[model samples]
Target: MPTTRLSKVFPEELSEDTIHIIVQRPPRDLEFMPKNKRIRITEGWKPYKASNGKSVDLPPSWIGFLESAELEPDPRKAFDYLKNDLQAGDAINIPSMGQVPKDFGIHDQNHKVFVTEQMLELWEDMRGDKD
Candidate 1:
């Protein structure tokens, strides 16, 4: 009679397949706020002068779109929105807030803004699993 080793059965597999099986996590809970309901930050810019001493263009604003529907201007509120409000494919618009060039259309689509590793680590941390 031959005895089979448990190592032969498992072999302590450590591949992508094993990792995928071990790290199965639930889908992220997403919340979307209406575009008009969110707060928009109008950043300030400097004025430019031409050789004729005439102001060439107005300063541009760095628009920070917040996820809160309440239109709050606080940084912490903005951070909260960044963390909880928006998802991967959200759309953003500049809406000609400040001195941005008229030809520049700021309406853009959001890509994978939040990295997967961060979310994965967060999920693992929440589960109290350290691997």
Candidate 2:
């Protein structure tokens, strides 16, 4: 049998609500760090500017969003939010703190952002559910 399009199952508005991510580079800061430390290092959702003084638009803040996966204080389900609710291109409009440091390895101005296999690998690794 032929398969139906995703749009047919979900309305355009609902589908459009999803974020479109084009993986440019692998995720950053996948380590489990203290929230305070993480906050200190992070600038939230601020735009990144290039050395040429142009606003650099990066991909959706999946790392920031998933960083809070275990915020519920439950061990057994520490990563349930990430494993179940979140998808690759979910809408992530959180305000970035400002700009990340150049050494962060995510500041490359040339790479285009999109979803990549490495991202999924990192996601599973971050969740600590890898076999």
Query: Global CA lDDT of candidate 2, please?
Result: 0.49
TM-score of each: 0.17, 0.20
lDDT of 2 by residue, 13-103 (tens): 4455666444345456636667766765674554656557786544336444433453323354443444554456553322223343355
lDDT of 1 by residue, 1-131 (tens): 22344344456854543323223355542324444333221233445655477764333422222222344434443333334444345543323222444445444532223335566457456756557
Q: State candidate 1's TM-score.
A: 0.17
- Each model's C-alpha lDDT? 0.41, 0.49
RMSD of each: 23.2, 24.4
Candidate 2, position 47, lDDT: 60
Q: How many Å off is the CA of 29 in candidate 1?
A: 62
Candidate 1 lDDT trough over 10 residues, lowest sum: 59-68
Off by over 4 Å in 2: 1-97, 100-112
